[model samples]
Target: MMIAIGYMLSWRKWFDEQSSRLIAKLVTQIALPAYMISTITHDFTAKRLLSTLPDLRFPVLSMLILFALAAVLIRVMQIKEEHRGLFESMFLNSNTVFIGLPVNMALFGNQSLPYVLVYYMANTTIFWTLGVWLIQRDGTHKQAFSLKTTLEKIFSPPLLGFIVGVLLVLFHIQLPQFILTDCSYIGGLTIPLSMFFIGIAIQRAGIQNVSLNRDSLGVLSGRFIFAPLLMTLLVLPMPVPILMKQVFILQSAMPVMTNAPVVAKLYHADEQYAAIMVTETTLLSLAVIPLLMMFVKSGFIT
Candidate 1:
């Protein structure tokens, strides 16, 4: 619904030419950093924080395997030189928060929340670091690869905010109540603004422009097919609780990272391509989900 609204507003010329760029800036620079801080500070407490780290290994490992596969696919598919980076990023990363969180809560109930966050933590960290690095390559700017530039890209605002929040939690540092409230209020804008960005991208791309080409089909297969199948193979053999395995598998099948388009736009990469994939996969995920539930219900994972 929010996405539709963004598209409508864009079609009506309700926004200026710079609207999408500004929206991306607002999200990545302001809203996302604050969101990273607030969510980490509030969601994970001191005691369980360490306990959760062990579970974190699962997602981290899952991403590493996915990354290897994406590398192979990039060479095999002969993805365009510019898009290779973004392709690898999208193929590996999942939208574990916006879509994954609520979906897990709905399907598996609150008991799965902890496992969901574990996946979110790993996904968020990698996306900001390695994922952002990959997107930079797809941009117009020629990356010479210096230690300085690498650090700057890796420790972007959102990642810094995540680091700050983690340090605060680990050291038992507490911000005043009002400050926490302030972060919460500003950070809350991340979702609506992102939906608007997507809508605007779709509007600009036009329904006529959207099509399932080789690139689009590869991304779809990565998200809906390869992703979950890989997760199933990895987690199926583990001794973890069934709920945690289920959450990990479902989270793996989530839509492309919402940040894919955001980071792509920020770096002057193919934002339109990113936006189209997002829309395509998001719509397909809705249909694919019923079959996914059937798998879970049928004890396929167990």
Candidate 2:
């Protein structure tokens, strides 16, 4: 309900394209890195670091399952070979950092923060290395996996923030009170900015070109339903902590990342199909996420 209202409000005409672009840039380049650095810096510790590493394996395995399911679904649906890259990328990648972090924080509070960070770190490492290669296998972009590109991705602002944050934690450096307060304010901007960016990107994609093709819907159904269901079932029999289980289920249930289209565009893949997949998943996930969360919480399927 709140998500719908937020979407509708964000779509209002007053929030023009220029404003949207600026907000996206601000969130992407400035606010997001700041939030990540602050959070990581504050919580950095040997125990937290060690604990966070082990928690990452579940999400990684869950993502692998999603990747297999997406590949199979693409083949079964007979989506064109040329467009399968778009489907694979869109279906496999969730917005773990930008979208998932804020949602998990809201639902579960600070205790779940480390899980979100670790999941995002795992996501970035996999997507940039394996995911990029998978989507760009046709050699559409010669620049894929070059040393320069790999270095750029590794040294990106978010990853750099994580590194610096950990260093700060190791040294036991204390952030001043005003700085900490500011960090909190900046971190809070992530959610609204991410959702607004979604609305803006969809608006830019032009609804006229958006397709509800059978293949696209198959990907969406797989992402919103099958992936989460499978992850819940997998976690059910395991001796994992309940919080980890909830985090996995919630992260799995998130819509395809809004960044999928951007990444596809960068790699010179089928950007139109990527845009369609992103818009479809984002719009539909609102309906699916709440129901899935409720089901997971009630132990109905798990």
Candidate 3:
């Protein structure tokens, strides 16, 4: 949390528009692909890759359930149709990549990496397909799924790494020492670079004209508290493995993804509201997540 906050603060002075653009290019085009290739090269195996699919069952289900709830909440609040897009956008896009990945690694170590890979793959698939469909449902002209966008999201560097890693593992292929070392060096940049980009993006989108009163509070509560609580109740009763359970719970507990606003903009949703939702949830999750983790550890939540 401190790290994320520090990046935000530093961005005020250090991150300019040009640098932000460059970072976006790097992340979207270059670094992400590199990260995917490395991860796929290292972990891809026929059996392990197949095993990872079952782990996805709960997370994907939870996402659908939460998305429905979010839609209902938006309607219940009587949010204008124009604003409903923002509300619906909040439900589906969890922080699976930047925040979730690092925390999962810290909590579960290398063994859990495969789970992270599958979760993210499922996440990107859902985000580009279902998520895009939802936000653009009310647009003047509906946006069809673009192959370019789909491929970019699916083959993003980190995801490609997962795919390659699984393939290698499946074939029992050994990576040369030099390739392994170089991949490690390049893959190491993903977290910091992504986080810094997020910080810079937030900096560029200054926190002015944000609505933080009751309506805003409701959005934050829905994303940070209500959604996770609902997921916990559903997930804890399931007979999935403990690691899978923890991963589902933790990912559910994540703040809104940074990409929420981008999607909102694309669909002509309330981008300001989306930004507020992302900011509020990200700020509040620092407290909420650790406490929730404690509850899970004590078997209180389960």
- Most lDDT-accurate candidate: 1
C-alpha lDDT of residue 62 in model 2 = 76
Q: For model 3, how does the per-residue alpha-carbon lDDT over 224-298 read when each residue is reduced to its tens digit?
A: 777677767776777766676676677777877777777777777667777777767776776887876676667
Give lDDT for model 1: 0.79
lDDT of 2 by residue, 1-302 (tens): 44444456556665676776687777766777778767776655656766667777777887788788878887788878777766776666677765677778777776776677777777777677667776686337756358678667646676666666666777778778788778768866877777667766666666667677866887777678776777787777887667777877778767666666667777787777777777777777667766766775775533
lDDT of 3: 0.69
lDDT of 2 at 157: 72
For candidate 1, the TM-score is 0.74
What overall lDDT goes with each candidate model?
A: 0.79, 0.71, 0.69
How many clashes (backbone atoms < 3 Å, residues ≥3 apart in a chain or on different chains) does model 2 have? 0
Q: Write the per-residue lDDT of candidate 1 for residues 173-273, one digit (tens) a residue.
A: 99999999999899888778877776776677567766887678778888899888988888898887888888888999988887788789878999888
Q: What are the candidates' C-alpha RMSDs?
A: 4.1, 2.9, 2.9
The residue pairs found clashing in candidate 1 are none
Please give the distance, in angstroms, between residue 39's alpha carbon in candidate 3 and its true position after superposition.
5.3
Displacement of residue 64 (Cα, Å) in model 1 is: 3.3
